[model samples]
Target: MRRVESLDVLRGVAILGTFGTNVWIFSSPGGLAAVLGGGGVVESGLRALSNGKFLALLSILFGVGLAIQHSSALRRGARWPGWYLWRSALLLVEGVLHFVLVFEFDVLMFYAVVAVQCAFIVGRSTRVIRGWMIAAGVLHVAVVGLLTAALYGKDVVGDDAADTSRWLDQVAFRLDNALALRAEAVFVLPLGMVLFLAGARLLRAGALEQSVRGDAIRRRLMTWGLGVGVPLNALTAFAGTDWALVDRYLCAPLVAFGLLGAITTLVHRTAEGPLRRGITAVGRSALSCYIAQNVLASVLCYQWGLGVTGGPLWTVTCFLIVSALVTAGAWLWLRRFPRGPVETVWDVLYRAPQRISSRRTRCPQGRSA
Candidate 1:
């Protein structure tokens, strides 16, 4: 399968928006509490604009990437998800390291776990895949619904937002609270599965194509997802911590679909340009940019570095500055290198096992030539 520019564009959009979503956590003195509990008006509105929507979009794109890998494996007569497991394992390791050292809200580990599950079924028949999607959807709805109902008139107010100025202490806190820190991933898994499968199906259905059918699909996604999903999300967003589950898990993904649809359509109509190319370059270097952004944000906002959590306007400004730097850095890096620095490192890691296996097969150490 050839690379899809539209998908790349969509990915670029999602990447930056994810930065938009996460910047708040890094900015506020309240940290995650600001999001989990309620912030002031500006914070709430800013959080509402970009929050779970981009994360959900990322989930769908991840699914699309996994499907592509599955297809590539079939094309080369490679075993389905045989070596993919190694890839996922590498991602898992990366995620773990990232969580321990850099950021607590890393998504790579969860994506790695879901990728393993999705890999097995990506090549299944349409009916089977659809069945899995439905099951995943039902599970997600049930879990979120129950949680939201239970939290009705309640709260998830997090602990003291100010981590000690020492970064290591923050790491220690995350380790001590590992289960609690990682619990959101457990709850978000079912929806992740659903979005993953949905992304694959959408790609196969040619939702990115410049055709009547594609347009029709995107229109529906835009109409229902944005048209209806936006209102529902806003309602929950400003309400309170009681509505966080409904806002993030349920309503936000609908807005994500709307975003995916609208952005893809924009990609279709637009021509190549510097701005477009830069975003696509960022998309190509997404993993690098993703990690880099978090690290940057941490140094800028955490108690140890700048140690200042300003108001919402300052927070938004920080987000924009960080995103612009990341974009420019990715674009500049890609100009000379085929891949981002991290991606280059990842490719090296990916190839090492294959090289070892090939040598073992060819040399046959026990047998004389």
Candidate 2:
């Protein structure tokens, strides 16, 4: 399939923003333990810039890709979501491995689940799709609401953190605290469903077009998402832990839409430059870059690697340094190779089963007789 430069650029941005969020956790002395506590003034302030916005944008972009895939399938006279199930299943396996071996808070597994559910439901009647989206949105909101109220009403006491110095022991620790570590993934699934469907709908509605209609769509998103969403999100940042649910789950998504609008607009208006080209390359090799960033960051920060623990600013600096290197590396790799290393492996795995299936369905050599 042909690549969309705009989408690729967006993906690059999302990839880095996600790392921005993850760096805080990686920098903390207690990996997963940091999730339940607040950070220093500078750290918290910087965290607000990323918090939940980019992750939400990433979800929407995933939906857009799913829509594109579904379209490709239909155009080829193939069954909808036929082998797509296999694709998502592969994603789930990747996610599990990532969670256990790399980052404990991997999003791939949950995204895989949402992709499966969405593949079956997309391209249905407008009313049906809207119903699903609305239902999921409402359910997610209610759940977030209840959780927020509970947090405000009472503090959440967490267990003392265990040592996370050894790589092997860290793997064991993730396995032992599976539920606790996986809670964020589970909690975000409903929102994933909502955003995933919304993204498909947006794609169908020409959300990425560069013309008049597309401009209008983006304008509205900016008006609501930036003009309204960003402010509320900022307020929540200062509102303390109780309001974090409001900030990340609710307000952050608003800013995501706004960022999409702003970025798309900027790309269309600006001429090609090093920064744009760099991000585009990163976007093309997004999966590979994402995994590399995490693994490299772990090597730099985790006890098993460089064991570089520090305040939030230092960790954020680490994230920036890693992100820059990955972007530059991807730019260099793509110049010689069509895909990144992991992407190459992923595509091979994705198509291997299909090759076998096609071979099985082929006629024998004597078919002419």
Candidate 3:
């Protein structure tokens, strides 16, 4: 009902949903390679449907959140521009730390950098913003599709063949790729800003606030997201296994957005129940839970905790179970604390430091000044 609660719920879902896709990396035989369907058809299919679709959904929500933050700032008469820049910078730092120290795949820092690019446009006219969103989404898909087609034609078949040089090349290739794409800028940051703009536009148009539109739109989004996500995902599974036509990066984001909209609608429309409560609780501590899940997952799969590296599909499933439990545990812990540990630090970063005067005021000394 409340804004923060609504956002927290969505953020929580996005965080967990992201893990839903990432867990495959933790529990598969070839690690991430297996989850990418390098192992076999069934595992690959499962991973595509689970991970691809879920991550897309998470990305779209990231956009929605950007809008929420901007809108909230404007509503309170706060000078949002400067504050957002600072916040984005803070996130960038956090993201970099996450990448270098904890995980090489960290995306936040990139997103933080990307967020700066669109700082000026978020508050612009909805039509203009919408145009940019459409253009970016379409261009991105087209480019990816073209690239996939070219690779397919070049016989660049997706293979798990172990090549010593290939492994070495991957690092260099990813670095160059990251730079050319402005990896975070093109892939996530822009997409998120666009999505946030759309969400804000929708909010302004009363899409979420209006009962009539809410019901109609929610139902439609849910239907379409599931309808398309299921079949296309099936196709993706088959393509990855048989043909390699399905580009997860390209198709997944679209499917995920539809699914996210659908789910958001369902969450709001459905009576508050266990599922809602659980998700909301998790959402409340989303930041902490998000980082925690990654850490927990890493330990489970790394040469650490269970040393369950290169495990089977079943093992990955177990990792999911454990991760979910950890999320629930974190949610429970937050019941008393109100915010996750990292979230608290984020708050400190975003909020002004408190000042306690050390100088004591001597009683006016019977002061008749």
Model 2: clashing residue pairs? none
The runs of at least 3 residues in candidate 3 whose Cα sits more than 4 Å from the true structure, single-residue gaps closed, are 4-6, 153-193, 241-246, 310-312, 353-369
Order the candidates by TM-score, highest first — what do you get? 2, 1, 3
Could you tell me which residue pairs clash in candidate 3? 21-51, 27-316, 239-244
TM-score of 1: 0.96
Stretches off by above 4 angstroms in model 1 are: 161-164, 364-369
TM-score pick, better of 2 and 3: 2
Query: Cα RMSD (Å) per model?
Result: 1.7, 1.5, 5.8
Q: Look at candidate 2 and tell me the lDDT of residue 290.
A: 85
Clashes of 1: 0
- lDDT by residue (9-100, candidate 3, tens digit) is 56667777777666765555455445544556666655665555555555555555666777788888867576788788888888766654
> Better model by lDDT, 1 or 3?
1
lDDT of 1: 0.89
